[model samples]
Target: MAAVTMRLSEIGQQLRAFRLESGMRADEIAARLGVSRAALYRYEKGEVIKLDTVQRLAELLKVSPLTLLGIGVEYYSRPIGFFERIRQIEEETDQILQIADPVAYLVTSPDYDRVLFQAIAETQDAASGEQYASIMAARKSAYETRRPTMITMLPEQAVERFLLRGVCEAASPSPELRDAARRVAAAEISRIVEMIEAEPIGLQFSVVSEVDNTANCMLMRGRERMVLAINPFRADTSPAASTGVSLITSAPEAVNAHQRVIEALWKDSLKGKEAADRLRLLLAEYAIR
Candidate 1:
């Protein structure tokens, strides 16, 4: 995550520097790219750059793609930079705020049961299953080592759909897939509710409204933060292709902005007993008694 963020930021800064050096305004660049000035601003701010756009920028700026990507000679040869940074952040986070359309499970944590993890894995494509296992194991080790605080905000409809239907309507395929998903979803939902009820490490769960288009789940660890946004193309077809970008920052302003967004969502979401009641209603609607 840190690697991704650092690279993007570096690239963004480099783009801005080059643009200024060329004595061109943002509007001029936006006009050339056929994008709005606001869109260009987002790129300059280091939000997330598309691969094609990076290529175009490299061509336009007369810089190598690797340099634009911040993949300095040494780092480019390594395969572990991205995952290693994620592990480091997990170990260091004092608190984590997770906002995801579908739930984000720390597989090794008590928050998720092993059976549920396997069930979810069964629904994945072969490659996804392999990746899931590796991620689950790594997350488990991180949880055991760090024991950071966790708060999760999920979309109300997703919870309702999963609990009432006993499966993720979005992930369903054939009848067999539906059944497998249902068993896993029900059990995982129950486990999650129970964990929240226990309030271990001040854990909290809430159902937020108006999250339909939100596909990313964020994890904030002290001065560092990571956001994993789902790849729609991957989800629709090859589960093994599930890809996301993780953003990391120690910048006070950036961290504060993310914290504020999480807090706002939390305030707008259901809380404590109210949240539990909502979960129960869904369970009853699904006949999970």
Candidate 2:
């Protein structure tokens, strides 16, 4: 019975993930499933789910039955869904192994959110403002409360581009807004330098030379499972990004491979005072440009 409950709980988590990816409301799904909304929420809360119901849900959510059974890949085309899923994973994560250019969203400066919201507002509809804000707040709150150990690898070239282009990637911007964006970018880099110098516990940041054909991904190590998310949607770089599909999987081989790659990169990457000094020099050289 205990084993069955645990399996059911995992299936519930997968159901929630794919449901968000499906972009279908609870009531809508309930109506289509011929079940009460309360019942649908109960399933998400880990109640025993019938096999027939699982088949119906797989059909409605456009995912294979094996996926809901927690044995298949989870694909997300919507950035909102992907980010929300990330938040869910991070909630239970013990540590995060991340490889992204510039910096990961969790380590970004506080002001980064405002700049990001503005850029997203410029590119996205006003209807999505509330949802975006909620997700942003939830992510920040989860990180603050959990404080998971994070090891991030950032590329030097990406940091250079961040300083050169600033945070706002909107198509057209007023001169004053552009200046403000650049200032924020410089401040963010400064914050990163400070972090590198401080060498805080449970937080590791390394800067590596730019390499060709690298993917943005993160591995979240949890108490029971390790999940890898290969994401192309970057809020810091491009707020209105919607072209790429993010892949989330718990396959051991996939997780092991990414972990190995991160270890290899960390071995040759610059860290501590050396990384701080390099970033400071980049800041000075790029501040004038």
Candidate 3:
């Protein structure tokens, strides 16, 4: 019963999002569906919905039945408070295991917050990106405050690319800003380097040469939740300003599958001294560029 209720709520949220995305007002949608505005409101509020009504709603919203069903995962489209959502999940989760892209986020480096502020400050697009910047700042605060355990996978080649050229639109920051960002990025990786040399508890770091980046995912062990984030934006791209998508689910089967994938990737990843050596090689190359 509880699972059904949860699924219903997820579906409702997705329906509302799709409707909004379609730019169809509730009255318009309700009238087309041969329902009153109150009935339409009930549908979006996760009230019991019939299959036929769902199909009709799908047609009205120009979405598939599966999309309206919340069949496998709950989808979020450039969610307004995306970082806040993650922050909420993080507070509940005791540990996070992430399969990241080259420039993975949620870093625990001592100087990361400073770098973040500088990047936001130096960027001309900050005003246009205010909502993203604010949410990102809040997310950072939440993580720093909660200090949840995290295992992060960093791709050696990707880090090299990141150091040489910032991700997405961040590629063209002022030389001073770029250089500052580079030094911070290098230092952040170096701290990971030190961690590789000196293994730490509660936090684990790995660098892989072979890209196991089939999908970027976060497994929140505490919340029994897994986040499948298909971000079209790069690491430097603010998720809030980007058109990427994220799906979250507390379904045990999905979580288990994600955990298995993370474990396999972790096993294949380079760790400790070997990973440290890889970072050194990259840094040496970066020194010239």
Candidate 4:
């Protein structure tokens, strides 16, 4: 076969992700590939590697040669570029674990899907940005169609806030518009309530009475890749919102650290009927008022 032309930086990313998700230390993988630790670091830094060495790397990582030649985890500070990359990853992800705001980012039911899109459409119309409209539409469509295995950790207060105030970003908007946003928010919360009660397939839902927002993020776990995105802003309003400095790693060290944190938090959090009843009480209070 002819040698494939792949960018060192991109290939480096795949190697790192594969290494991390595989839960192997750099030294272990490097030793298996018959390279010094420093050489392995250089390879992961996008340094040139011989085609024969690429074959060794594929064997060590237990992946096809093409996998290493393809896309890898990336970090982005810019809004448009970061969101575009995230949209791509999200579309491809088979499982998602999120530390959500009032509304869950993914795993929303079909009835609530319309509400989420309406919130996005309203936010887009207010900004008058055609590009964002398309981006948000694509994101919503991807989630609706894929509906990847979903798990979320939601803050109790944030859910109450979202149910009441909604995510409309209109500046001094009309009452009817504001009402629409609230309805969207309400529906989004209702689905969570429903999920807890129904426990649909591929859905794992939970609510935590208190969650440290600083550590919250959306963690997408793919079969061969993993992305940990840190976005400070609540995503209920728009999928294209400017995420804070995000971390994308396929390295075992970092991904495992995050996994431990998620497990610890989930253990301390509320779920099943307990979480549902608490939310239901809030729902009733908000509705009756």
Candidate 5:
């Protein structure tokens, strides 16, 4: 049936995602599974997959069988894997609805990338840092080319904190890095203010006081499917990619639940001049400090 074929296709897609996250080569996985490399590639291309094979692949991939089958949540503990998954989903997305507490990385200026790299590069070796840089660049490029309709809700308290601590809050940062971080924060927030005032097509920014959460939640909607990602890994905050677990799911129930929450909070969010003025006040208050 058509329905069964579509389900297989989704499962194949999930297989590729988990494979990327696991960092295992297709030939290696195929060898372990006692299948040919060609067969593994075929499975990833939506060929028929046996239930027992799904179970074995789940074990090999370190994910639950339900997750492999697209029937349960996809868990990601590494920020690189999580963001890479997001980048993959965004490749096909036409609309993005997000609640990225302080600001969304997509709207941030280039200087923001420099600040982020400074934070990540501090803890990583040269090679790992370069890998992270590539992922960031790829994400930015995907957004530029796709130009998805994005509606983002930001928390006011989070913005205040971002202005206070800057993007990278190292345990003991040098004076120069601290100052640069604050300057980048100010510039990034000012850019948000400009966006609010401009009301650009296909982009919307709203500052909300009630949503106190710092986690990033996004619903990426494509032509045939939508994905919900709840990520604790923040690009701005520079949290270790390994420290926190993220949830990615496509179940209708979970999607509907998160949609309800977004809808409720969006009603009370401030936009246009009101939002811009609020951000300006924060900038002034922080600049005086």
Candidate 6:
């Protein structure tokens, strides 16, 4: 199941590459296909490329269907293309607005200790010392070359739980394994906060009862915006699973609709000092200290 999902994701990446090489704009492709630009954008994002669209893209790119689908080769044998696209987006984005409910660290500038924090927070049993160390090293390397203009909206309850559990405390762990996890989480959270404070970025928080109701993150870039809506529980259970149904489109109307939704949410959100105060209040309520 993992291999299949990975292959499909790779194919999406290859399709995007070919589209770039062919010098075809998404709008041009959409016009040719008699669909909205947004629909074509969805195809590129690997949001369920239809069989017919796959055939058409193969015909257009001059690649065989099997090669594009990545069927005959090892799945991990190829590089993950979506990561490269993410890197490209980070480099090119003038601004980023991230809404994270369950976790707050994935898109932070100075990087978050995603693996260690996730492991500790999700498990009652401690991780191995080696596992904790390896995740920290990987986290450091991943953040070395990329930085994005970021605005993050996090739910209050998630933050409260994170702090109350001492997820960010250096003393939370006793054994070597738990200690390593604790240290990593504390360091990474501090680093991220510092980076955000030093940059011309925005970090906000709110108590949105509707946050969990919405099941995806929205990335806006220039005139192009990508909406990634995934079922969280399903995704957590199967980390490598493809988004069952993702809608990626560059149609002006669709993009406008998403933008409007984002704007409305932002307007209702707390930013700057207000956001910090709210966070402090929540932390106090949870007795984080």
lDDT of 2 by residue, 181-251 (tens): 77888888888888888888889888887576567899999887888999887655342346889899888
In terms of lDDT, model 5 sits at: 0.80
Instruction: Give residue 11's lDDT in candidate 6 (0 to 100).
Output: 70
Inter-residue clash pairs, candidate 5: none
**Runs in model 5 with CA error above 4 Å?**
1-7, 10-54, 170-173, 237-240, 287-289
Number of clashing residue pairs, candidate 2: 0
Q: Give each prediction's root-mean-square deviation over alpha carbons.
A: 12.0, 2.6, 5.6, 11.6, 3.2, 12.6
Query: What is the alpha-carbon lDDT of model 6 when measured against the actual structure?
Result: 0.47
> Which sequence of candidate numbers ranks them by TM-score, best first?
2, 5, 3, 4, 1, 6
- Candidate 6, residues 149-256, lDDT tens digits: the string is 455556555555454443433223455544444344344344434443454434334334335445445454643334232123211111122334332333456556
What is the Å distance of residue 156 in model 1 from its true position? Answer: 0.7
Which parts of model 6 have CA positions greater than 4 angstroms off? 1-92, 102-147, 161-212, 223-238, 241-247, 287-289
Candidate 1 segments exceeding 4 Å error = 1-88, 101-104, 107-128, 164-174, 210-215, 223-239, 242-254, 287-289
lDDT of 4: 0.66
The best candidate in terms of lDDT: 5
Candidate 5 TM-score over all chains jointly: 0.84
In terms of lDDT, the poorest run of 10 residues in model 1 is 73-82
Question: Estimated TM-score per prediction?
Answer: 0.57, 0.88, 0.67, 0.65, 0.84, 0.47
The candidate that wins on TM-score is 2
**TM-score result, candidate 2:** 0.88
Global lDDT of model 3: 0.65
Candidate 4 per-residue C-alpha lDDT over 31-100 given as tens digits, one digit per residue, 9 for 90 to 100:
8888899999898778888878888888876667755675344544334334544566787789888777
lDDT of 1 by residue, 1-289 (tens): 8768756676665566445434356788888887899988888767788888888876775656875676632111111223333444465567778775335456323423344334445566554445435544676688767777777887777776665554435344566555655666666666667766877765677877656654444555655344331222211122233233333444456556666777788898887777777766666677344
The order of the candidates by lDDT, greatest first, is: 5, 2, 4, 3, 1, 6
- Deviation of model 5 at 33, angstroms: 5.6
* Pairs that collide, model 3: none
Model 6, position 280: C-alpha lDDT score: 50
